[model samples]
Target: MIAKAYLWYGVYIILNVLTIAGSDPSGGAGIQADLKTFSALGVYGATAITALTAQNTQGVTALYPVADYIVAAQLDAVFRDLRIDAVKIGMLANVENVLAVSSVIERYKPAHVVLDTVICSSNGYLLLEPCALAALRDRLLPLASIITPNLHEASVLLGEPVAADEVQMIYQGDALRALGAQAVLIKGGHLLGNCSPDWLIEKSGHTRISSVRLKVIGTHGTGCTLSAAIAALRPQNRDWTNAVNNAKIYINQALLQSTRLSVGLGTGPLHHFHAWW
Candidate 1:
């Protein structure tokens, strides 16, 4: 009876999420951003690091990918112990790491998976190799519940030019859906406009989410934050549109709050914990 009671208590404690990505020393992106966003949104976060990056707000200086076996071991440890409700995947530095992540996803099949196709840094540093990108497209896209890609990353994935306007963004979203993701969110923050709009394309239909683009320098981790927020929200909401909408609201507030503080020299990071303080 006591054991059953303990199990019930554990079930109600907190929704657990696992983030498989790289480590950013600056804490603005990668696993750091995912964990922060998950915690802020009331989810318990676990991590399995694919790489370690020496970087700051300005850019990534160097990257050291963890061995494939090590990445697999971390994922195994998390899955064997935690009842993970969601997953968020970020920068995979190489093909081996991508395969490692793919293997675990197939094995565990977490309920919600948000893949932030992090191929490059905000400052134009390459995070994933060409082979890694191919691997991700082939192995991981079909598994993700939703994929959040900025204008540039979407362009890369679709093998075309940048999405110059909303029409093109929608086209790209559909194209990405054709690639196998359950839903595609093409972020328009890089577009030239007063409002940043994201196109969410699902088989049911498509919708646009637009927010006033905050003219702020602290926008380093926006993609990671958005995707992580979606992953954290999915378990409760169980609706992709609501999950994405809530994430956008959270990110907008975080960006607004971050503008007041000075964190780094270059493109700064969002105040991920703004709600708490």
Candidate 2:
């Protein structure tokens, strides 16, 4: 038994990271942020672009959804070539894209699956169409190890805007669990308050996390970065608490550093590479 345990441990260490998220032409969010997080944590990152957006820190202007078959092909190519350790899904813009990625997840059953429900742009632009959301709820939610939804997405998923309050957030988690997600990480940024409180609710129990409200006005790809950090760290046997805590620390530092540099003309992206300096 000891020898077998040691072997398993060795396997885990060797396969530390893999992910599938959308591409951000702006390079502030989506796959760019995910890959940066993975690299920062010393993990290899992989991705399958779901859609392409023509926008930057300011807002998304135009989006072109990748064809369903192309999305499937990207996953197949990655699976055939690499030993994927974990997956982080974001920004499925259409029903076909959702179905395509969900089908792949069902087949491979990666060790860790983090879903950053990118339902809309940070500026309140609709990223996922209504039909796509329907597909996500019906096909994808049940498969995720954890679904990270901000207040707006959580409210939309439950058919109502969950009041942005502590008591209401807990209820929102329960409502999401009832919908089939094994775990719901309701991000508290949208809550109208001085401090943002993020909550993680699971079958066994719940936990609350908070950070002093950030002063930075531009936060473009923060969600994607958070989800990717969680996925990258999860394969190392870190619990969700540890995963989220570390992710928050990384994001906070990036945001603080990013506030100093002017990136885009509109809303700027988190300074993902700031750690180097």
By lDDT, the best candidate is 1
Candidate 2: misplaced stretches above 4 Å?
1-16
Model 2 Cα lDDT, one tens digit per residue, 1-277: 0001114544534444555666778788888888887777667777788888887878888888889999999998888788787789989899998999999989888877898888888777788989778889878998998999988888888798665598898898888888888788899887776888999998989999899889885577889888888887676654878778777888888888887777788878887767776
- Estimate the lDDT of model 2: 0.81
Global CA lDDT of candidate 1, please?
0.88
TM-scores, one per candidate: 0.95, 0.92
Per-prediction tally of clashes = 0, 0
Q: List the residue pairs that clash in candidate 1.
A: none
Top model number, TM-score = 1
Model 1, backbone clash pairs (residues 3+ apart or across chains), number: 0
Worst 10 residues of 1 by lDDT: 1-10
TM-score of the candidate numbered 1?
Answer: 0.95
The deviation in Å at residue 148 for candidate 2 is 0.5
